[model samples]
Target: MLHMTCKGKIHRARVTEANLDYVGSISIDEQLMEAASIRPFEMVQINGLRSAQTWQTYTIPAPYGSGEICVNGPPAHLFRVGDLVIILSVGFFTESDLERFQHRTVLVDEQNHLVDVKTYTRQSAHHIRGGEGK
Candidate 1:
């Protein structure tokens, strides 16, 4: 998992789901897309592609139930419906939610694109609270 140091107090957060995002108007690899069509977990990556960016979707491995973030890869069925993730917001709570989110997960039937983030939640907090930046 990619690690970023933040200034705010660090609390043990659990991972819920990993969502994939691509740059520009590019779409997931045709083969990977087909795989996801059958099995969401069956995905592949085409590095150096014109219409894609590196992303990794991460999820808690259980036990503590930590947060999950999807980065540097494609979307897959490894995730289920109704999962939680982290939303790194600007302030404690504001109108601009940005890309940072908590308790967000991919929808069951909406994994075709795998980048739709509208289905995510702010963990158990209902909304994103501000944490001091590092």
Candidate 2:
């Protein structure tokens, strides 16, 4: 059996732009993508902190170190610049894979700058604690 598990997360990333004209998808900083091990076109779940809205979208890499987090297409209307959002990507894993599975969480500052990158194994999920962003 395969279980869906979180592969990576970008926590507390602020929206830098919202482009209603674009086709669709979220643009993330290349650095952030690398830190979280998120690949371009990978499906992600975005949760808005203030609005409490959740949506699914794919990721596109912005310039390296650009600190960009843009919402595009119709979803752009649901977000705004400066909104704090959590982006998560998930993948399917078999029982054996879960034994060694580790997920990456990339924490960011208010300005969407990388603060830290944390790795969590299934065993550590309940024990680890941090700021609200995580």
Candidate 3:
């Protein structure tokens, strides 16, 4: 049983069966609709994953086929294609609480997957030790 608190109420959810091959989700209450801003039994895609904080993304069925939407409260900077991001909770945010990212870029593909643009580099200890010895 997973509980998602949103709109000052608690929502109960169930994940009956889940494996690397497939995932199943069900909700017995109406909170799922309010939380995700989508109707019941709708085909939604995971737009982005939430970190250990408040952030999530989901692509809903819009008149234009599909539209990816982002909901952020806490900030995290890691994403890739075909990753299943869980939606922890949802809330309303004021305009002042929103701000742009400093050094990151995110783009969504036609398939509603989020693509992160950043380079990651790893330096060995030998490289740092050589500079320190000099």
Q: Identify the leading candidate in terms of lDDT.
A: 2
**What tens digits encode model 3's per-residue C-alpha lDDT throughout 16-132?**
112332223222123233433444444332223222222233322223212222221222233322333343333344433322211112223334333322211122323433332
Superposed model 1: Cα runs more than 4 Å off: 1-3, 7-73, 87-134
Candidate ranking (TM-score, best to worst): 2, 3, 1
lDDT of 1 by residue, 1-134 (tens): 33232112112122224344432121222322222221233222212122233323222221221222233224323332232222221123343343353333222122322332222233434433452111
**Residue 36 local lDDT, model 3:** 37
lDDT of 3: 0.28
- Could you tell me the TM-score of candidate 2? 0.94
Listed per candidate, the RMSD to the true structure in angstroms reads: 15.5, 1.4, 18.3
- List, in order, the clash count of every candidate structure: 38, 0, 0
Instruction: State each model's CA lDDT, in order.
Output: 0.27, 0.91, 0.28
lDDT of 2 at 76: 89
Residue 33 local lDDT, model 3? 38
| lDDT, residue 80, model 3 | 27
Q: Which sequence of candidate numbers ranks them by lDDT, best first?
A: 2, 3, 1
TM-score of each: 0.17, 0.94, 0.22
Q: Which candidate wins on TM-score?
A: 2
